[model samples]
Each structure stands twice: as structure tokens, then as C-alpha cells.
Target: MNYKQIVQYGVLIFGAIILIGLVLKGNISHEKFDSEKWKNWTETESELSLRWDMMNSLRNNHELIGKTRTEIIELLGKPDSETKMDFRYYLGMSKHGINTGSLTIKFNENRIVTDFSVWQG
Candidate 1:
């Protein structure tokens, strides 16, 4: 190819790489746990707001409760840890020196989520 054509192709390839990186970043950033939200959240805040966020999180992830292992992985990616009968995800958010909390999800032998708990640390 001519020098100019080669330059054009290089720019296009670079742009594609950058775009793919951004898309992957976006997916990772929108995890089942949102630490920044928790960091800013104070126990003293309105109960309504806290409940809202909690409910939203559950709503978004409730589908995993009954999904097969393969299905959950397709949607939420691989868990931090896994076993024959359970899966665990340790995740959370932090910002401005304040951390919201880490959330841990538990799944049952059926490969469906059974419960979740949170810890502020």
C-alpha cells in the first residue's frame, strides 16, 4: 500500500483499539457492586435514598438468583471465586477517601444466588 494509505490504516486500527478499551472499561465499571455510591452514603442519610439504591441494586441483579452457572457468567462475568455448589463475588466502591462497602454474593449448589451481605471497610 502507499505511504498515505498505510497511515490511514494505522489511525483506523488505533481508533478501534481505543474504542474497544473504552467499551470494556465501561462494562467493568458497572459492576454488581458500586463502591463510590456506598462511600458517599452515610447511615444518617434518609432511609428512602438508601433503600432506593439497595433496591435498585437488587433489581438489577435479581435475575442471577435462578440462573444457571453458565448463564450468570455470560451476564456478570466470572465470579471472584467458585465451587461445585456456590459462587462468591467480593466487590464494592470507594471515593475521596471514603469507602462505601464491599458486597459479597453467595450462590447455592444450584448455581443460583442465595444471599448477599455487605461490609464497610
Candidate 2:
């Protein structure tokens, strides 16, 4: 057509392209932000390390179980004696309160606890 008509069409086409680009960018960023937030949430859940220091609490009092020999020594200060059986090692629990129980740990080799049982007296 004429130069003016051609120029007007060109401007209209350029504006339409810019509008489409902005809409596409906004949609892409919205999706990306949502995915990033979801990734952060999942990673945060998996990064938790919860340790139960039951033996530490037990040592301060009179009875604790499932602790390594070092932990027992640190907590109870000392032990009266140590005994070994065919299946496991025994850490005796003395009476500190109403609950009196013994901690038994079954070992496979050396002194590793493979299984455990608690006997309350």
C-alpha cells in the first residue's frame, strides 16, 4: 500500500510482538518461581537430621541404654564392672527412679549393637 499504511502496519505488528513476548515471559517466570519454591520445600524436608540422645539423659540419672561404652563413661562417670555374653553386651541399669531397666545390645562382631532389648525391673 502507501508508505503511511505500511508504517502503521509495522508499528502495530511490533506492538503485538512486544505484548506477546511480555505475556510469555511472565508465564515462564511464574512457572519457574513455583518450581523453585517446590524444589526448596522438598530439599528442606530431606535435609533434617534428628538424633535422639537417650543415653545422655539416662546417664545423668541412674538408667540409660543403647549408648556406646564411651557415652556410658561420659554419662555415668564409671561402671562397676563389665560383662560379655555369647550374643550381646550388657549395660546394667541401676535404680534411679520408679523405672528400673537394663539395656541389652546384641553384637555381631567386636562390640557393635545389631539388636537390642530393654528389660524393666
Candidate 3:
């Protein structure tokens, strides 16, 4: 790459790293990951540190068997995006310096959470 192109790429990467840091602050847990914790924190996210803090909140604060979408939103703030039966939250994933992935929450007709999954791209 030319000098200017390299500088531009460097700047973009640095900005991405900073943005990820902001988005992840206090979002994940310091403890080890466990299914019970709703955290699959691993290499996909670069092992930097992210805990699915919102998901953890749902598992801990609400009754997953019956919690409504509105109730969940109240705790996690607005979702990054949503669709007919799915809501998405982005935690800024980065593996080997490339960021991708998001958390997807699926709901039943009653708007109650059936389960959630991670989308690693």
C-alpha cells in the first residue's frame, strides 16, 4: 500500500478500536464465561473482553420464561436493530483485527423471549 493509503487504513483501524472500547465498556463480565452467564466470549471477539452484558442482565433480572420484549428493552436500552420476531444487539466483534457479529434475540408470538443466538460473520 502507498504511504497515504497505509495511513488511512491505520487511522480507520484505530478509530474502530476506540469505538469498540466505548461500546464494550462495562458491558461484559470480568468472570469466566459459562452458558449460564449467557456469555460466549471467546476468540471471535478477539478475547479482548465482552460479556453480553445485556443478555446477562436478562438472565439474571428477568424471568426468561415469561419476560416480554418491552421489559427486556427497558433494561438493555434500545436494540441495535429488530425484525418481525428477532432483535439484534451489536457488541462490536473483532477477531484478528476484523470486527463482525451481533447478538440476536428471538421471540415468540407472545413477544416473550424463546432464546438468543450469536451471529459471527
Candidate 4:
């Protein structure tokens, strides 16, 4: 093959590698929400088994935006941390392996969930 053809093939290969890496890093698992598994996860297991998959399902399948704080706790168990207006559930490490993740649910004066977010640190 000519030099130009060889360079083109090299670029294509590199692009494919990058695409695959991105797909894997994104943690494309779509596991359904399992309360048992979620509540059972300990800190040590949390680092190795990320929960983004189940988190995705929990966010999508559950209508938590308007639920009361008590209702959320009934569904998701106790929070790892909490304040007067919010509850934060430790969701384990991120798939990227660099940051820990948590789900923060914010409540309003009436103790109802106003908004929720998934965050990493």
C-alpha cells in the first residue's frame, strides 16, 4: 500500500480504539433497580461495583420529583447523609474509577422532593 493509504488506515484504527474506550468507560449497563442489592452494598464493595446502572433505572422508573421525603426513604432506604432540606445517598464509585458518586435529593419547605441529581467527586 501507498504511504497515504497506510496513514489513512492508521487513523481509522485509532478512531475505532477511542470509540470502544468511550463505550466501555460510559458503563452502558442498564440494570433494573434492586432495592435489596442497593441496600446491601457496603463501602468496600461500593468501590468495586458501581451503581450507575441501577441509578439510571431508579431515576427513570420512579417518579421521585414530587414524592415526600418519607416516601423516598421508604423506597430508597436511609441516606448516607442528610440535612434539613436534602438527603444524599452514597451510590458508590463512578465507572471512570476516579470519583465516588452519590445521589442528592433536594426538598422544599413542605418536606417534598423538589429536585434530585447524581454527582461525582
Best by lDDT: 4
Q: State the lDDT of candidate 1 residue by residue for 62-82, as single tens digits.
A: 654566777656544565677
Which prediction has more favorable TM-score, 3 or 4?
4
lDDT, candidate 3, 51-89, per-residue tens:
443445545655654568986676445677998797887
Cα misplacement distance, residue 68 of candidate 1 (Å): 2.0
Off by over 4 Å in 4: 1-26, 45-47
lDDT of 4 by residue, 19-117 (tens): 998887667667888877776667675335446668878887899999998898888888999999999998776767677788999999999999999
Ranking by TM-score: 4, 3, 1, 2
Candidate 1, lDDT over the whole model: 0.54
- Taking all chains together, each candidate's TM-score versus the true structure is 0.39, 0.26, 0.48, 0.74
What are the Cα lDDT values of the candidates?
0.54, 0.40, 0.63, 0.83
Error (Å) of candidate 4 at residue 98 is 2.1
Per-candidate count of clashing residue pairs (backbone under 3 Å):
3, 0, 1, 0
Superposed Cα deviation of residue 55, candidate 1 (Å) = 9.1
Best by TM-score: 4
2 or 3, which is superior by TM-score? Answer: 3
Consecutive 10-residue window with the lowest summed lDDT within model 4:
43-52
Model 4 residue-pair collision total: 0
| Candidate 3 ranges with C-alpha deviation above 4 Å | 1-65
Q: By how many angstroms RMSD does model 4 differ from the true structure?
A: 4.5
